[model samples]
Target: MGFEEDALLAESGLIIAPDPESARLTRTITGTDQTGAARDIRIVEERPLTIFLNSREIVTTMTIGDFPDYLALGFLKNQGMLRPGENVTAIDYDDELETIVVRTDQPTDFEEKLAKKTRTSGCAVGTVFGDMMEGLEGLTLPATPVRTSWLYALARTINTMPSLYLEAGAIHGTVLCREDRPLVYMEDVGRHNAVDKVAGYMVATGTDAADKILYTTGRLTSEMVIKTALMGIPVLASRSGFTAWGVEIARDVGLTLIGRMRGERFMCVSGEERLVRDADPAAVAAEDPRSRRKGSRD
Candidate 1:
């Protein structure tokens, strides 16, 4: 189905831009099945993207190779290296070298910050510096209410979209939504990478965060909670479960965390004060049967 412009604008009041298409998102490979049958399968392509801030090498991430520029910007943003409204002069990417260098007008020194790297629970290996949560204390999210009707519509639209996760088996999806409409959707090998891509996209487009919702296919971990909170997004929903630390941080930060969200069913572990039960539970249909994936039952 086409992304109706007026409906999206009315529902979310945001620019529903199309995800940049990439030719290298997937590749076909011949593989043998358990029955010894040779079949061609389309597999997602992952490449190492090493990010450099000016002259210093920052971090390397494995991603689906689509939107490397956004991935680089978002990675630095979430890592607390790139501050909000930081002036970026140039972002140079070398496909052959598998590296991206972000240049800014101001000098960036993170010798002490990088020294305190801590591993996170996100898949494909996630890391956070000691001061990553330093600015979260000052973050203030708007008291926007989330409607049950919006939740149902948002899930249905995201599930119907053609995504790398649905095409290939091993991928995670993160979507930026405004109530019932999804504005930007991104997928990557790691859930953190996907969220970073979305963060970068929002920064690039100057999207407002006050009334936005963040959706993910991965579980809610502390990293996920922190990243969403850093983005200044109040509402975060996941089709998967949540970790103990994730809920703790969400509660501490007052982020509206919703997990195990399948169709009409959802568990709001925190920030239930922001949920508006606008839709009648009986009127909402069960999750689309075709939308069921590996973690749909979770």
Candidate 2:
């Protein structure tokens, strides 16, 4: 069925979940490289999307022009606009207007929330309310283990996969993994958007998070750490470094935080008790050249 038909069904009762394939928009553009060489290259298309909740305008975000419905839902979910178990009536996306309207059963009043917005360090510049951390104290993630073998395998698998980041440069990726297998891989200009899409996908599908690991190419910033904890996911891994605040929160909430992961090496900054050193570091092979990301050099 078409999106309009599916949207109607969603308004009736069903929620439209995000599929991994829905988040890709590619275009070819001519650019000049070093040595004054002109080349035609495919790039990820980006566009601004203004989202409205019911009749009130919420926020505007630059997205990769894919999965508007899921991106909208996920953005709201992470921003603390939509509460858990809140009935999402319908999500309508208009391509021509570049807008998405999400209808919910509960009424939303965000005048105060919008007034207290703060810009984050996310690549696309993520914003959150001053009181966004209000409910984080009550969230305690499950006690999940990060097996050495699983970590090695997951990183290699994700690195080798054909993704939007590999397809076009200048993008970040987030993956939801179970042990050695990556189930959902999302990429966007902003790391927050990528992770939010994964969050929205989880909410729509009712996926359990207790045993899952959240991986990202973005830094382990406070926002990333808090979002993963809110999703009830216990483990967070990244190929980047961590902020001090990010480390403190993870340590306090007992979220296993792993960073600087390249090749066969990684550092778990917090929740060290959850890591099982089952695989020998010497036995692990070097990172596959094809699996390296543009942003991993740091």
Candidate 3:
């Protein structure tokens, strides 16, 4: 399909989408199959990306090395290192050093916060510094109504879209959607990185998240719930299951949490009141077998 046609197929217009064909993102390696036959397979590449906030080195993450700027910005933003309405003067990246530095108009320091890092369950060893719920106090997400129809449509469109996860099995995807239309699709070695990339995009583009839906291929964990709430997005859906803490946080923060979204079936653990059951499950098309990913049935 042509670019426009592909865009229309994925319902991703003008916004960022995964480029699985990019050489820098993946590499071909020789391996043996179950039959012991020699085969060549493409594997997603993970590299260290050190992020610096002004003069302090914040943290280093393992990522697929695409949209480094967005990842850097989003990481800082979600971590509360970069405050809302904070002026970002420049974002400088060094390809050779695999480091990205986000420079704000004012100098910043987070030595104490960095000292209290908590390892998360995300693949590639995700880390969250300080209290996991630091910035969520007194935070209230918009009470945006999510249509069942939009959820179904978004699932079909996003699952079938060409993505790094489908291209290489090791990756995870996080999509920012406005109702049924996906705006930005991001993928990385860690789902947190994908979330941060979308967060960064929203920060850079000045996109409002009060009405947006976050669709992810990873499990609905507390980290995911916290990040979605911090981004000001009302809805978070996934094709995977949820963690108890994740559900609890969603309930506390009043964020809609939907999981196990596949083949016209989903479970909303929190914020079910906001769901408008406008779509009939019988009328929704069954998930295509070709669209199945690693955790589609989980």
Instruction: Name the top TM-score candidate.
Output: 3
lDDT of 1 at 201: 75
Q: Please report how far candidate 1 places residue 145 from its true position, in Å.
A: 0.3
For 104-186, candidate 3 gives per-residue lDDT tens digits of 98778677888898999877778999899998899888899999999999999888888877887888899999888888899
- Tens digits of per-residue lDDT for model 2, 223-290: 99988888889999999999999999998888999999888899999989889999999998898676
Estimate candidate 3's alpha-carbon lDDT, on a 0 to 1 scale: 0.88
TM-score of each: 0.90, 0.90, 0.94
The weakest ten consecutive residues by lDDT in model 2 span 14-23
Cα RMSD of all models vs. native, in order, equals: 3.8, 4.6, 3.5
Better of 1 and 3 by lDDT: 3
**Which pairs of residues collide in model 3?**
none
Number of backbone collisions per candidate, in order?
0, 0, 0
The weakest ten consecutive residues by lDDT in model 1 span: 1-10
TM-score of 2: 0.90
Q: What is the lDDT of residue 280 in candidate 3?
A: 93
Per-residue lDDT tens digits for candidate 1, residues 126-173, read 988766577778566677799989988888778777776666668888
